[model samples]
Target chain A: MDLLYQIFVDPFVQMGTAPDLLVQTLWEGLVSGVLYALIALGFVLIFKASGVFNFAQGIMVVFAALTLVGLYEKGVPAFLALALTIVVMLGLAVLVERLMLRPLVNQPDIVLFMATFGLTYVLIGLGEIIFGGDPKVMIADQLYLPRGAIDVNMLGGFVSLQKIDIAAAIIASLMVAGLAVVFQKTRIGRALRAVADSHKAALSVGISLEQIWVVVWFAAGIVALATGIMWGARSNVSFALEIVSLKALPVLILGGLTSIPGAIVGGIIIGVGEKLGEFYWGPLLGSGIESWLAYVIALIFLLFRPQGLFGERIIERI
Target chain B: MRMKQLALGVALAGIMAAPALAQNSIFVPLLTYRTGPFSNSGIPIANGMHDYLAMLNERDGGIGGVKLAIEECETGYKNEKGVECYEALKSKKPVVVNPYSTGITLALIPKASVDHIPILSMAYGLSASAQGQDFPWIFNPPATYWDGLSMIIKYIADKEGGLANLKGKTIGYIYFDGGYGLEPIPLLDQLAKDYGFTVKKYPVPPADMQNQSGLWLNVRRDRPAWMIMWGWGAMNPTAVQEAAKINYPMDHMIGVWWSGSEDDARPAGAGGKGYLSLNFNSVGANYPAIQDIQKYVIDKGNSQTAKDKVGDNFYNRGVMNSVIIAEAIRNAQQLTGKKEVNAEDLRRGFETLKITPERWKELGLEGFAGPVNVTCTDHNGHHAAYVQQWDGTKWVKVSDWITPMKDKVQPLLDAAAQDYVTKNQPWPKRTEACDKSS
Candidate 1:
């Protein structure tokens, strides 16, 4: 009886008594969800265009962020550093297309996936050699990112929201809206969707697979830069940020690997679910449940819809 | 036939390299992690250790006329790679091995007795390994996690007016949930019971170290009067940032020594001011020994240490570690009456090692660390540690060396050591005995 009441009655009662804290928790959940969504968006862009799981997306986030900061530290102007970082990302996309994806174009999906694994190590080694393995402060101040928190009185208490978190949510929404426009209205968007449907048919229709690959990879690189900046603003920019990229996998599973909107919705679900689970139900299970709760939520969702919520249905003619 | 010829050639090369290894030097292999997720802290510590040994080789011609041959085998702070490095370097006949991470230290504890090599974890391994009877081959000198925890509790008690004032007050503990981070739980639990205080535990998994809004939100909900952290690497800075976000008083929050580096607080800028962390070694390059290290190692461009990180907390802590090891070598040489010493001789050296004030002055590290004295029964020297406050730019010492509650901590250590021995049956028994001097 005591266990039952503690499970069902206590958390709700606590929420009622301290609505301000509840608001704070929900806001935090939303902010983290948006960041996770951004990372998932990177994975979705590449997967949608090329059917290859880019394992290096996480390291690319770190590498892009590190390059921006490292260049700024070397006396380059902040905006120039930003522009140079974009050029570097473009070069990276071209290099990946020419060296890795081009040779393995006709191979099995697993081969391309394994190739990204090699890319992950190469980037790690190169990043360390160049950046010297030290955590650097993100150029948030130079980039005009906000700081401090805003406290508002509500529900007979105060709720604090970080200014940077608010900015992140806003910037992420804008980026997502921009990507949606590019995918739906642009000529490259048609070719991308056509290739995503069937590579042979798209090629027969005069869409160059190589050109589409480079564009999608460059788009993913931009998403990675946005993610690195937002997340690094919250924490220090270091190799440890790579691990947080794994959080996007569950988001990918929940949102559908090929659906951009699915990535956002899936990210919010995992992020909010993880926070609420850890805050209310985590004590019952000895805490640290946040580490695996997102995966479990994604797994349950997969059980109901094997193709994911926004993913296209698979209809085989065999 | 060609493959066999190649194999024969490799065997001949291996045989020829054996005699060259036994020439005139003492080999000490350092299993370090200078590149990885933990490299933010690992690089400085590795640089300190490397620079100190190099200083010895350059200035004094090594300990007692034997050149110190220091080799580094990078483990990248992974347990599997640590074990691999151990196996790879064990054939080199190193006098002692310093497994930097607690996971690697635990892995090597059982192997050390069989291999007849001593393991020196310095301030960060299993708290129960301090019991010399059960863990005869492993040494965590200067202090243990239990010691560090007791000191923090004592300091908090003193600040709160009295130990009785802690009753009914909730103290929160946020830890990394790994072997090293979870080490102080039993001691903290025992202390809470004795003091009548309530303890709330918040664990941060390694995967979620950078994403700890959930933990801090819980912190806000619980509203504990004081919070202590057992975090490392990237977790340190993130936790500090979250605490600042929730407007937690930086003075009321404290971190363990591993979480006290400049890297931990520099990211937060001024918001991290007044944050407290317990430290065993002094920070700064004002010491004569550090000056020698700069002149001999860095100036010559023979060191991998960054010029700016010469006197950082973790770097200085690394130098302190080498000081203990080098002094032990000197002690062993004096006792054995030989220029070169073996692993068993190093063990005896550790048992009888003493870092008195006079010795510190002689070694040119007069005020760098607390005096350490190791006995046969106590692998941990039970030395006191000081609390330092982050003053925005650097850490400044704010308190004297505060000793742990030995009376309260010893029984727990003994019981834990016994429990470990009972669990790992057929554990080796200690055959050597010495006088108690603490």
Candidate 2:
């Protein structure tokens, strides 16, 4: 009874007394949640159109950012280099469509999914060879990211929120809202949803499967580029940033692959939950809970709602 | 096809001008990581390696009039790939290799001896390789793992008056769960037992660092006087911030050299004020070699980092690494004529290297490193380090240089290394090269 009081109830009692720590924890969760959603948006864009989970999306984030910085360093202007990077991403999309998707168009979902694992390696090798294996500073000054922090004094304690983190949360939310509109209101978006429902059925009804995939992949690349630049600025741009993409995995499992709103909510829940767990209960288990807490959260959620927050019930047919 | 042709052309060119290009040339195998969780650290180190070599060629027309050849193979921090790199480069007749990882060094020990490749692990590898007879081809200049751990205790001991003062005090050890991390556990445990200090262990999962409340809560409850971290990658800054959240004394907490680089600084920059660390070499803004690197290399736009990052911790460490390797090769050329040097020649060269204070001033690496003596039975060229504290913006040197407790470290190293041999059972074939004079 004493141990339970110490482990489970003590942290909340402290939080209740010091409401400021609770508020600060929430803010940290929101900041991290925004980043998670940003990564999930890339997954959502591709999955919405092609029903394919891009296992290479994480590498794509590193690849796009590396290419842009690498080209600019070689004397190309920043904006022009960004344009060139867009062209490269488009070229990559076309190559994927031709070499991978087109050949496996009639293949099962598992086959297409397996193909992405191979594509991840190809992007990694090509990125390293062309850019030289080095991390680069992101375009923080040129891109005009906010600098410094906003100190807030609340409930007898003070906490700081970086201006850049605030800017990121706003931009990420706006982008997600814009994406939601595009999916719900645009004709191309409707065609994408149609194709995602059944590829053969959409093809038979005169939808151009080829064009929709290109557009969806291009959008996914753009999302990756944006995440890369932001995360790179927050930290240094390195191949290590490749693992940040995995942070989105639990977000996917919790939010459901199909629901956009679910991604946002799930991201925030995981983010806040992990932070709170790390702050409160982590020491009891020996700390370092932030790493695995989200996966465990998603696992427990799966036990109850296997279809996820907004995913349709998975049906089996003989 | 193109690379094969290029390799052949380079090799043929070497043979054709064999005498002229002989012992003067320094060949270095750079086992690098371009991909993986640690790439952020690896890439900059590679850039520093390449940039320093370039500067040597440009500033001095190469060491002793022979250019340096730094061949890099992307290992991504994997032991198997590192072994493959060693196998591929063994026949290059090179003198030394900088493997850049502790696990990789452990794997390369047998091969380094078998293939006659001298390894310069700097401060990032197997601590026992510091024992020269058992590890003739391995060299770890500056501090080793035990050195880093002992210094942290030494700092604490001084504050409390003596080592015996630590009795009943709790000390925390939070680390990534791996060999590179667990390398210091036995030493720490022994130290705790010797001093009667209580020890707490917190094991972090790989590639992620979100929750540390469990460990911090214990710290709050137990109130350990100091926390010593042995971690890598994102774990460093993350651990620092987690400690901060729990209000652990940032000044009292110390990270090992690997965990104390600038890459670990920026994330918790402001939040981790007064965080202290043990650094093997003095690699920061104040080093003279850094001014040269900035003016000659970075200012000339040959840097792998932003121009301003020239004097950062990892970058200066890079410069220091280049300085040691370059000097070793320079020393090797004396016994082996500049035209006929090989692995054995380089080993002899390293054995005689003595980088004095005067030499450091000349090389412009003055204040960043200490005097180094490399000999047949002492593969670790030096074993001195200083404490530095982050005053928010940059790392400021706090203490004069400190050496590990030799009585404490030597026995632990010998015992552990001997165990490694006994566990492996079959001894590796000798890595010694036949000396013409002998």
Candidate 3:
């Protein structure tokens, strides 16, 4: 009864008493959710177009960030380096599509996934060799991202929100909206959907599968670059950032694997839920519950809706 | 018949020539991680470790006239990989093995005596390994984790006026949830009990290191008067960033030695200003030994180290590690009168190791590090460490060298060591005789 009281009643009481901390925790969760959504969006783009779960998406974020920072460190201007990084990502999309996807086209989906695992290692090795292993400071100042925090006095206390986190949330939202516009309205979007539905059928209808793959991958690369900048600004850009990408798996499970809006909603839910769980209930469990809480939430979601909150439903006539 | 004879003869010749080739240089295998998550910290240290030995070979023709064959096997900071590297390299007859990771050092401790090679963990590994009577082949000179923890407490006590003033105060500990981070907890808990303070624990799992917003949010809620971090690699900078975000007092927050690096602090930028961490080795390229390393190693295009990172914290740490190894080799050479001393000879050197202030100057390392002494029953000398504060750019030493409370620490260390031996029943007894040279 005491344990139950501590679990169910005490947390709510604490929440009521310390509303400022609750807001801070929620804000942190929202920021984390935005980042998770950005990474999941990259996964969504590739899976939607190619039907391949791109394992390389995580390393791609690190690689893209490293390229931008590496170029800037080599004396290239920040904006120019950002442009070159985008170009590099485009070139990478072409290279990956040509070398990895084209040959493995019409092959088993697992084969494509395994090929992405290989790409992850290749990017990790290449990033280490080119940038050297030291963690590079992201050029947040040069990129005109805000520094410091905005302390708002409310709830009888102050809630400090980092300016960079605020900027990141705005930027992530804008990119997601832009991706939504492209997917819903553009001709390329129709081609990608056609390929995602049925590759052979799309080919029969005169859609170039190769072209769609590159375009979708390039789109995913753009998402990854945006994610790398925001996450890198939050921490330092290093190979370690790839591990945090695993957080997106739960997000993908919560938000449908192929749905854009689902990604955003899923990210926010998992993020906020985990933060709240960790903050309120973590002490009872001796802390460190934040690591596994997202997966637990995802597991509950899986039990109810394996297709996720917004995923397409399938029905068999047989 | 001719083909068979020639193949057999070549094989015989190769077998005969192998030992001869090994005899010309001293083999030292560095279990390093230049890739993976910890590479940012590992790379600089790897370079420093490699560069110093490479410098010795280039400048002094190696310790005692034998060129040191320094080789690095990448562990990527994984325990299994570290053990694998150890197994693969142990056959090379390496005079000493420096398993940089605490987990790896723990894995290698039992193998050390059996293999007849000294394991120099260098201020890390099992804190109980300081009891050299039990862990004769394992040397973690300078200080142990328990020592460092006590010193941190002592430093805190000094700042707060007295030990009595710490009563009713709460101290938060955020640590990497591993053997390395967990090593100091028993001592810390004891210290908390003795000092009348509450200990709030935050264990950062390896996976959750980068995402520590939840951890810091808890900190903000708990409102601990002081925060102590035992973080490493990416966790260090992220913790610093999160702490700064929650408006935690930067000066009140302190990290262990591994958590304090340019890589750790620079990412946090101006927000990490006034953050404190402990250090045994002095920072900067001002030391003559460091200049020699730059002159013979980095300047020669031989070292993989960047031009700017010659005197960075982790790099200097690696250099100091090699300095101890080199000193051990020299001492072994003098005692055994062998140019290329074997592993057993090196073990003797480690057991009888002593470096005074005069010796520090002689080695071109004046004021670069505190003096280290490893005795027959005490491997780690439990030296004093000073506090260094990050000024947003570089570390500035802000305090005198503060020694650990050895009277309080030694009892705990002995009990822990005894507990380890009792648990591992078939633990080998120390049969190696003490050297008369000591």
Estimated TM-score for each candidate: 0.97, 0.80, 0.98
lDDT of 2 by residue, A47-103 (tens): 867778989999999898898888888988888888998998898888888888888
Docking category of candidate 3? high
DockQ winner, 1 or 3: 3
Indicate which candidate wins on TM-score.
3
DockQ of 1: 0.82
Docking outcome class, model 2: acceptable
Q: Model 3, B13-86: lDDT tens per residue?
A: 99999887798999999999988888888998998899999999999999878999989999999999999999
Q: Give the clashing residue pairs of candidate 1, or none.
A: none
Candidate 3 stretches greater than 4 Å from native: A315-318, B1-17
At residue B246, candidate 3 shows an lDDT of 88
lDDT of 1 by residue, B66-185 (tens): 889999989988889999999999988889999999989988988887788999999988888888778877889999999999999988998999899999999999998889888999
Model 1: TM-score for chain B: 0.95
Worst 10 residues of 2 chain B by lDDT: B429-438
By DockQ, the better pick of 1 and 2 is 1
Model 1, residue A51: distance off in Å is: 0.7
